[model samples]
Target: MTSPATSDSAFTNNSCDTEKIHILDLFAGPGGLDVAAHFLGLESTGIEWDANACETRYSAGLQTIHADVRTMRTERFDELPDNINVLAGGPPCQTFSVAGNGAGRRALTEVKSFIKRLVAREESSETIDEELSALGDPRTALVLEPLRWVMAAIENGKPYKAIILEQVPAVLPVWNVYREVLESGDLPGGVKYRTECRVLHTEEYGVPQTRRRAVLIARLAEHGHASMPDKTHKAFTRPKAETAPTGMATLDEAILKEAEHVERPRANRKEREPWVSMSEALRESSKKLGRSEPYVVVSNYGSGGDPKNRGRRTSDQPAFTVTGKISRNVVETPDGQPLPRFTIPESGILQTFPSNFPWRGRDQAQQVGNAVPPRFGAHLLAAALGLEEGRVAEAIEKMDGWPQISEEERERLRKIGCGDKGKCPTKPPHPQG
Candidate 1:
């Protein structure tokens, strides 16, 4: 029998996790994080606010809860698994993204504190204290929500021993706030003031897309340790290229060499529409093309009534941040002319979703808007884990030689030959008959 999308993927069966870890993915969409975590052998419970996202996760055998993290605490839960060692989530980052006018940065004050308190409560639980939780709290890094939550969780003792938060580069100021907060010792947890923050571009880290995010990593064991997962992939170069070399990765290189781009059969597919090419975007905006183009423009004036026309889009530039809101996906028509809405898959690919992956939301916009780029998130998490980021097949090529022993077999041998083996040595006595 053929396996479902949930059932079989060679890459998933052998992700970098290589061990077991527990994860709580808050605001996790379609369980992309869950899928990656599961690949790393981490058990996950995905909590997503969107019903469509919940269904997508459900197809993967995840215990996907459809509820907003912002409202989850107010609502009571019947039962839940024990203390989570790892807590993870990407908060809905609408009001605080860099793409918008530098407004809504205030989302931190409005909602971040509640999330902090939630983390505090979860950490205090006897159930949770027993295990490690890798949680990405606050979703957005606005006002250092993740750091603040970590501070709360530790509460003078160590709660989250390891924490990693991802955000847009524009949020560096907030990270500075994290430094200030932890240093001030104004919150809970034993976290010290000094932490580590770095810029991690997904493209540089083996993800096929051109996404750069600010990553914060902290090692609580030290007097003060805040660190992030380091980069693994490098830029694609000329001459003879090396695989897994600490170099740059190119869009064409990663996509063609690594990502399995979908090629829908022309006969069965809808007639494809050709849009302005990259070169077209590089040209100057047309003076004649005002907001009058309805199908092509996303302006409020003239015919540009569509909400997608709020901003200028060009092929040469990376797209604006892809938010949970689909209304942001519109673009002005080429030639400054009016045009139809961006195709769901088109907008989705712009956000870095693999072409072959399918989305499940009711509308094309909903599906494209709700999803996190699996390839990007996968690469980021892999980098965070301090392991290589590549598909199983790609990874295989990098290894000097394949191990003769299977992982399961090696694990069994390890149990018998390593852990507690010395305490109680066992052997078959010499049988001399």
Candidate 2:
């Protein structure tokens, strides 16, 4: 078990009043956390800036305030239902992602300094605005927006009962600062919080992707304490691993002989199932596309520019973290014959979105790539609320796959379509809503 951010007692909140709680999700991209809250039967009001994301959220029947979170004040939240007691969000991570340029990397020092100032009650709105302008990338400072909201809520005496946050592993240190401040009573008031921060591999929670995120959960209630959820599955086996990392099962040479690709060894006793492979998730897409044998997706860019970093994942394994430029992943037959890139529907499935979940507006890929897998979010929210994971089953509404495309649509796509480096279109022309 991960250590608590404070020396407070580990209070297993057995309060059956979880249903009375609602959530206010910040930087609420397409309602990822809201979806999870819904699965736990919790109502939510989300604030987001992206027009496209708001459209998608509204279409999904989620409540949303289509505006920048920075403009949100305590007064705006006052209009929400009185049941709002949980605050959750995953900030835009482009600046913090290791896959990006060094903008977020360079801004880390200043961001940390800003955190310290906030904890010291020295950061004013004018100072914040000036420093945010200096950072060049405004999103880098967005990670601190949740802290602002929490502070505002506390001052208003409407402190949240629970708080949940997620970001790339690069943001772990920032969250650590948050952990210390919340638990050490470093805020403006004497209200110390119980908190825990850890890096969680999504595959271990049964997400069909190998994404890892820094998660922090805190609660202000007297009996409130939060910790990482127990792993339900094992980590995906790497192409090469001399030793297994924590929470990952060790695979001996003998176990590697059972199949062409090694199944991630089971770690927990609760569920011994293998990690869900990309093949398992897109079996129908493979059949429809007339490709059943194993294949490779070679991305145009990877962690860096190294050809060795050409982000490649075989069908038998969970996919690498999908990115905003996900369409750049080029598919090729096992024998090295080039094929098309992944279709939008296939990409949505990789992100664990419903098959027919409508992706609205331009930059659709970014919306899908940035979303938290609803499945993973459900597990985290359920665990935080001390509720049975079974509650999510009834809440998940299934949908159909991509609608069929007409020849007219096909022609239009071909005329305007291109791939990374001007390659041919991946999936056939379909409606881009």
Candidate 3:
């Protein structure tokens, strides 16, 4: 399929300045940031590496360049709209995820050293490449790709007005280093920006999962102060006491009183609605299919290759963070009798993908797993654009619904599996996206 037309502006400029605000999303897996930009009535283009994710982006009518961000820089930048004001990306985080093999943690010190060397202009071209090659795992340095692009754009006199990046919380310190470099105007070309780095819990922003992301937002050339987004939903707090089983139930009487007497903690009281749970989001969908009460779901609790890390999620709580293996999540009855695994549509719902959004191509679960929840993304974009509170709330609500899917698409995704040896109940050679 052909790419979306580049001639058309992604968004119009309503401000006194004539330049429009288009977003260029680097490392744009499945176009999550683009989806959020669209919700705000903005235009965006994404550069993604994986073919399956690119295919999903294409099928959904999103503008995308199906190539690696590292290699696509020159050609893709040349095609960017004149007013590409915002740059956003969520670089692949497996190398930096806390739940993974300690590669990210172990490499953190070296990654920070690299960032310092990069900023200090201490390494020659040969040494830079040699050192990156010598790292224990080079993927840890993928987080620096955005910084490279930012410097390049600035040097070209086309610095993005706003920059946004998100990753697993383990990447926070790296973002902090980026914040220092961007704010200090330390680059050879001397571009200065204001940046804020923070850890954001997705549930606080109304995503129906407890995912935490390390986020950095920047305004180029100190155009304005950069602020992290405010939460739109109530934060889920556990009792001070260690309640058995769920670890969130009852606390000592004094502790409960202390909790009530203390400040509400969250900023916005008017909009502090309760957290939406997996049961609440999926209940109606399940009932529509005549599934009975007492739904049960079993899936991995953490991201790792080990089976021991897998666990279950009751209907009452929001699901553990959805991962690339999400399709393997089993839906069962009360007695542990397995029903169907979560259909692709249901998994999308959990991840806040619009209902019926085309999830075609290979590695559907990975594509879905890696995506930023559109609602959460919309909230962050709204904050970036300084959209009014009313408008932010409105956009989020609109994104919360399921996209309508046709039976043909549903049938196509039925029995979706990884298709690895012995992994599929069906036959070998599972359909590739």
Candidate 4:
């Protein structure tokens, strides 16, 4: 279990009773967190870059800004409504991701440049080093991005009362940096926070996906006694004589299959054509897209438990960590062709993203491969929003209007991402909201 952030117990919150929360989603790829906000009837705005993602956001009627967050001024955002309650998201984790850590290491230089978007130039690197010195050391510098923004908030005396972040376990090494740079720093007032993180399984959070993410929440409220969000779902798997059934969600149970009556364009069939064996799509996509060589799941395994468990293990019980490099190989095909690589929609389902959610970018594989599922993002948002227990369920209402695809609409989408061949499995075209 991950330790709780410094001390949510520090103080009881009094402001939430008096106001509604507005969210500013940062590095907000496809707005998974916002989807939860929508369900709750809350309003949110997101910043994402990628033509496809932009198109998706607009089509969904979300107030989205298509821009590089690292290029925008974090401080300038204060101009947004004062009711803004939370800042939440799983930032682009590529620079901190375990897969292609070599790629991450090389990309760190670009990631580091994002700091300028937060800290003022007058703030010396010495100041940053000094503050970080007080917090714990992080495995990768990517941990500092959130801290930079949080520290800036405190420096400006306009801190968002709460902050939330999500990533994979590979990001834990940088905890010390968070403690020192953000928590340990002296803020405008006595305002300071403690950091805590846990490795959380998305399946445990009620999402069918077996995604495990590192979750952290920081609060301005003093830590007298903090409270962790209660888990709503228990772990389940196939029942065994020796072990009780671990009723884990099958890939089928987890995905939202076709919406009934999707005829004439009302069907919500979001689930991929039920896990077609790698008969033709794979071979044809291979030939058409020249994807002849099988792709790899690039990452490392944990030390404890079976080391073999660290790498890929095909099972109905658990899934390999999601990565940008999904392949037909993770689960394996009957013909030994590897598990059929997910269509972007299937990838989103695995990530707990809702159907009809749009993804942006020329690289469908890379974007879905890198995104945090919205369903999981919703949990983190619930924690950040300090939502009342039963109330969190209300957020699903926000998706009630998540737009629909008509037969005409689906055809239009297939034309853009797939063309005439029907081999491309990218996200649907953005149906303008």
Give me the candidate number with maximum lDDT. 2
In order of listing, the candidates' clash counts read 45, 0, 4, 44
Stretches > 4 Å off in candidate 4: 1-19, 74-82, 102-142, 176-185, 222-226, 235-315, 327-341, 394-401, 404-433
lDDT pick, better of 1 and 4: 4
Model 2 clashing residue pairs (backbone): none
RMSD of each: 18.9, 10.6, 9.4, 13.8
Error of 2 at 181 (Å): 1.0
Hey, what RMSD does candidate 3 come out at? 9.4
lDDT of 1 by residue, 1-433 (tens): 2122123211222222334345556667765566555444556676555556544444445555555443333232223244443455544444344333333353434333433443445554323312211122323332333443464346424254344555555444444455445455455533444355555555444343344555555433332323344334453221121121222133223322322323333333333222222223212222223322222323221112333325443443334444445454455556665444445544554454433334554654655554555545554455334444345225423222212334465345334323443322132111100
Residue pairs with clashing backbones, model 3: 355-402, 355-403, 361-433, 362-433
The regions of model 1 sitting more than 4 angstroms off are 1-18, 74-78, 98-102, 106-158, 180-194, 206-210, 222-226, 229-358, 363-367, 388-433
Q: Tell me each candidate's TM-score.
A: 0.51, 0.79, 0.79, 0.61
User: Local error of candidate 4 at 177, Å?
Assistant: 4.1
Model 2 lDDT per residue over 172-205, tens place: 7778788888888777677777877777778887
Candidate 4 lDDT, 1-433, residue by residue in tens = 2233333232245224313567777766656777776765567777665656655655555666555443333424544455555666665554444343333333343334434423335666445544433333222333555665665555565676667777754443333234333464454455655455555666655554446566676655442222234455655442222121123123112211211112233234232222211222233334554444434331234322233433433333334445566543254433455544556654555555554466544666666666666656666666655566556655543432366545566445434422453332133212101
lDDT of 2 at 327: 90
Candidate 3 on 1-433: residue-level lDDT in tens?
Answer: 2122234422222111213667888877876787777767788888766667766776666776655666556444565556676788986677666445445556766777777787776666346545654565556557777887887787777777678888887777778888888888787577777777777778887777777777888765435556666666777663232122222122223223322322225455476678878777767667766666576777654223335544556677677677887777777887888787776767777877776677879888888889988878887776565566777677666665534545554434321211121322222111110
Q: For each candidate, what is the lDDT? A: 0.42, 0.67, 0.66, 0.49
Regions more than 4 Å wrong, model 2: 1-12, 74-77, 240-271, 288-291, 303-309, 392-433
